[model samples]
Target: MNAFQGRVTAALADPTLKTAIDRTTNTARSKRAAAIAAWPEFAQARELGRDMKDHVIANMEYYLTMFEANAVKTGAKIHWARTGQEACEIVVGICKAAKAKSVTRSKSMLGEEIGLPHALEAAGIERVETDLAEHIIQLAGETPSHIIWPALHKTREQVGELFRAHHTDPGELATVEEMVSSARRNLREKFMAADVGISGANFLIADTGAICTVTNEGNAELTTTPPRVHIVTAGIEKLVPSMVEAMTMLRLLVRSATGAELTQYTTFHAGPKQPGDVDGPEEFHIVLVDAGRTTMLAEGLAEMLRCLRCGACMNHCVVYRQIGGHAYGATYPGPMGSVITPSLDGLETSQDLPRACTLNGQCHEVCPVAIPLPTLIRGWRTKAWVQGYEPLHTAWALRIWEFFALRPVLYQLASNLALRIMPLFAKGGWISKMPLAGGWTRYRDMPIPQGGSFLAQYKKRQAAK
Candidate 1:
């Protein structure tokens, strides 16, 4: 299993996030299922969004060039990074040039993907996470459990404990407010002393060369204003043709992610320092990290870039409920992450991800961008076979199955034979011992290959007619 899959397994099996996810999922189902179920609207919407993303991505070079030109015109500098390592190197170099001793960062997954803080730490820079959930996880020296709500694994009392322990002088007090106050006071010092502020952009407007951040706590502003140098890291596909499209994307983002009408703060920054802006970064640098996006784009899978990342899919997935983000072991997790992460990062490491889903299609339903995630997952399966990574036995079995199915006479004959033999194999109307089914039988009772095959039943009905 790759790090992401391993993490996913660990997360699903994790005593904390498991319980938290279980309760959260159950509660969401109880409280919001009616509303979510009403949205038979998701699948169609996702496809439309996917087309828009694909169209832009197919012409990505043009859009990127336009965005860069606008960004430069706005007096900010943009850097191109072919890989995560290169992106970090460029950011670290900027930090070094500014003589930055510390940086206060909002939740930037790309920064984590590149291990920016570790590199900065190596260069003697102190980095502090400014988001409340992130700060909790950071102080615990752990990764985030949930993408939007990082410390979802940590309960209220657990948070209180973390705060009391991390506080400069604390005997361990109680209450969410006190915990919040302590965290705020502690982070205030880091924010005040930091020389650099770093973040991730939700969308980079190609028309205006502007980047936008949406947050609940108003921390996005603080993250940029406290430091003389503000830097943003973004995946190259984060670009859109104009702020108009960006606005449309944002409208869908908040609603799809948390079911919110709007975020607390939706701030846009164009370039860097301004002539009369009293409080803003003196320099702004946007690092567009290609990593494996270009490869994905080239391979005709660029539709994944249409994601506005509202995270509604994660919120509603059965697997993500049973498991959590940490188990996926990638910067991105949940339904969209299953395909995108492995595609960007590689399946050799993320082989388990495609198998991790139940193929129930909740992800595709919730996806605002309409990326057919399950179909994308099936594509990954084909890619794995093409790479010679899949077992030959499984590949041969697939071919045999496909051949029979394509030949209707042979498939029906085989189905009739299996239906005839199925009853003999069944014990108590269930098959506990079956080939390639150990994983299935581990938790579920496999219904005896029932009522003959669907083809057999359908044929019998046709004959009756």
Candidate 2:
């Protein structure tokens, strides 16, 4: 078995994983549905968001340059990193130059994408995750499974155990609110003592050179405002034309992500503290990491750039619900991650991701910006097959199927014969096992075909009509 399959097998064996994923994803799915239903102009907003993203992607350099100029005018330094490692190095260098000893960070997928935490640790800087879910995963030394709900896979019991293991408190934590209060009390000290803070940008406005951050917990505000130096790490594709368009996208983002009208705190950092400002960072830096995004834009995969980092697609994904995000073994998970991971990490290393999907199109249906996730996944599968990444057995099977498929008469005859022959092995209208097709029947029983091929059934109905 491949690495993904191996991980999936292990995850499946652990029933608690699926149980946790089911509860969380179900709630998220319901909330998103209700939020979308409540918004009368959601469809129009989705189209506008899609068009705006497409426009920015078509003129990526223009928006990026505009953003850089405006940000520079505000005295905010812009660092361009072509790769994840370079991005990590830039953040590390900034910390070292400022003589930062402790760093507080908000939950940033970009930071995780570049392995920033490890880089900071390697640089001898103590890093504390200010976001509660991020703090939980950080204490456990684990990567985020879900994008929005980072530690959704962990139960409250598991969280209590993690806190008890790390924290000085030996009291039994019974409730989530109590756990939150404990974490808040613990993180407040870290926030005050932090020399620097790092965060992710939800949207970077080219007109004003401001980075938009949306969070429900207000940890992002605490992380950015308390620290002396503030660093924003984000992908180049996050650039928008202005706040007008940013608000439009934000509307779709919040509802699609967490089923809320808006997050509690939506802060924008243009630059360092001004002459009249009271509490703001002395240094403001924005690291625009290309990290394969430019390549994706240059290639035909620019549609994937419209992603808002919302976990809506994954929340409704049946496959993701079954195996959970850890099985994907990437920074992003679910339908979006299936395409993003392979697109960024290369198809050779992540070829199995595209094939893992069921092509149900629920992801495409619920996507805020109307990304054709299944279509993109199909493109990845095609690329993988063309690049000789598919297995020899699969290739042969497809070739044999193609031979009959090209000839309708042969295809129909073969299908009818198989339909007739397969039922001979069925017990009580279900096949428990089959030779050479054990992969399908091993996990679940396949119902015996009652009629003939679809064409035959259609013809019979037409004749009767």
Candidate 3:
């Protein structure tokens, strides 16, 4: 097995990880259902959200240009990056120009996508993650396993232990609250002393040039408000035409993300602090990263762009709950990740992702923006097959199976022969061992063939009747 498959096997065997995933995702799914059911107009709202996103994607250039112009008008510099490397360079250059030694950051998936934390570290700048979950993972030297809840895979005991090792005065932090307090105390200094603050925007308004972020812990507000220089890194697809349009999306976002009516803090930072503003950054920069998004749009995979990043798809994904996000081995994980990863990283490297799904359509059912995730995953599989990305042995096996499958008489003869030989491996009507099928039998027993094939048995039954 390859590295990805090996990781998946390892994850499945980790009971603690599986338990964490099941509990957290089940709660999220239940809460989301309750919240959506409470809203009578949710269906209409979802349809409207889909339509709005489709419109923006269709006229992406116009909205993007408008946003840049308005953002520049508010004294915020707009930087465009066609790739992750360019985005990282732009951000690092901004920090270098500001002579920044440290940066306080909120939770930004786009940052994770471009490996921004590593990039900042390489430039000899201290990166402090302000979000609680993100800080926990950062202290543990681990990547986020979930989009909204970065430390979902970690238990409270695990977090307490991690804090005990990393935080000052480990003796003082015995409880969850104490650990949180210790983290806040440590991060408060970082927030004030940092030369630059980096954040991610959930949506960017084209008309008013505002960068909006919704957070439950309010860390994003501090991340954007403090420091001399502030940088917002976001995917190019996160654009809305107006505040009104954004509000509709936000309604769907909060409900789908945390199953709350709204997050605690829904902040809008419009082009840094104004002249009279008492508490705000001195400079603001927005780095829009394409990084294969445009390629996805060009290749008719634009539907994936409608994703709000709410993560509802994964919450309801059977495979995700079984093995968790780390098993996927990608920046993004679960159902949505299965589709997007291949699009961004290419099918050759991420081929296993598409095939990871059970294609139960639960992901599509739970998706707030109504993206057909299962269909898109299937599209990637088709692309893989057409491009000959499948393994040589598997490909040859399928071809041989198909040849017999297309011929009824030959297929029946083959099945009869297989049934006659089945007793060699069958034990108590279960095939515990099978040649060339160890992958399946290794996990669970396959039932032995009882009597003749179903087609042949059906003919015998008809004759009997």
Candidate 4:
């Protein structure tokens, strides 16, 4: 194994990441009732967002074209980046143009997708994450495990301890409020002093060129204001056809993802600080990043773009429950991550990812937009197999299968012979070690041909009928 495999192994070994994944999945599972019980608003929001997402995905090309026009008309400079590296360059150039010394951001996963903070730091500007959870993950030098609540993995006690260790001026660790206050005090200093502010849009409305931001704390407000220049980084798929679509998305977005009637704050900023505005940025920039979306749109993977980042899929995912985000080595993790990341990043960088699942269907059931995750992963598996990414033994097994499958009489004879001999090798109706199947033995048991082959069983049933 190379450094990549070594990194994969190390991330898989990290118990903290696994704990976080479990905490998230468990919370998601238990919160389903609470989320639905507190229905009406949240349910409406989820359905609204889901419908809006589906609508927009169906007409993505039209909406993107419309959004770009409106965004330009609103006096916001628009930069189209086709790749992650291009997005970083676009953002860095904007910061540099404003002569920025430091930048503050409000928890945009797309920023992490493009490694914006690293690029900003590399360009000699300090970029600080202002969201409480994101701030924790950033300070810890880790990628976000959970999407909506980035630091959901860490308990209040853990945060207090982390603050106790890292915060320069702090009080005794007691309540979550105190820890939040400590974070607030520290982040406030950065917000007030920063030259530029960057945020991710929950929804981008084409009708009015609005960037809709939803948040619990007032940090988003401060992060967007108090800076000379502001920028919004978002995937192109985030566009909405109209304000109605945005409102619908917001309705479903809050309820399904975090079970909030309404997020603590929801704001739609149309453009730069208007006249008579007491405090807002003077310059506004929006960078539209495609990364691999354009290509994916043309492929069978387009539906992956329908995701609203609700984090609902990971909540129901078993594979994500066991291993977690860091194990995948991508910005987006869990169910959506499994599909979108590998499609965008390709197999060489993410060969182990699509194989990480057990073909579970929970992700699809809970998805707000109904992405067929298992089918997508299987498609990627087939694609990988064609490219020889699969083990040679697996390839040879497939070849043997094809060989037998092409000859029906020969297959039936071989099948009958195996059925006769299978009982001798079987223990409790399962074969522990199979002759030509390392795949079956690696992680699970293979059931023996208990009664007979499917053909034989079907023939017997037919005869009985």
TM-score of each: 0.86, 0.96, 0.90, 0.84
Candidate 1: what lDDT?
0.78
Best TM-score among the predictions, by candidate number: 2
On the 0 to 100 scale, the lDDT of residue 294 in model 3 is 94
Q: Model 4: per-residue lDDT, tens digit, 225-276?
A: 9999989998988888887777666665676687665788999877787888
Question: CA lDDT of each candidate?
Answer: 0.78, 0.92, 0.90, 0.80
lDDT of 2 by residue, 274-346 (tens): 9999898999999999999978876688999999999999999988998888999999999999999997888
Cα lDDT for residue 216, model 1? 88
Q: Candidate 3: which stretches are off by over 4 Å?
A: 170-175, 408-438, 441-465
Deviation in angstroms for 383 in model 4? 0.7
* Steric overlap count per candidate: 9, 0, 0, 3
Which residue pairs in model 4 clash with each other? 45-251, 45-252, 46-252
| Number of the top-ranking candidate, with lDDT as the measure | 2
Question: Per the 3 Å backbone cut-off, how many clashing residue pairs does candidate 4 have?
Answer: 3
- Model 4 TM-score (2 dp): 0.84
Q: Where does the lowest 10-residue lDDT sum fall in candidate 3? A: 167-176
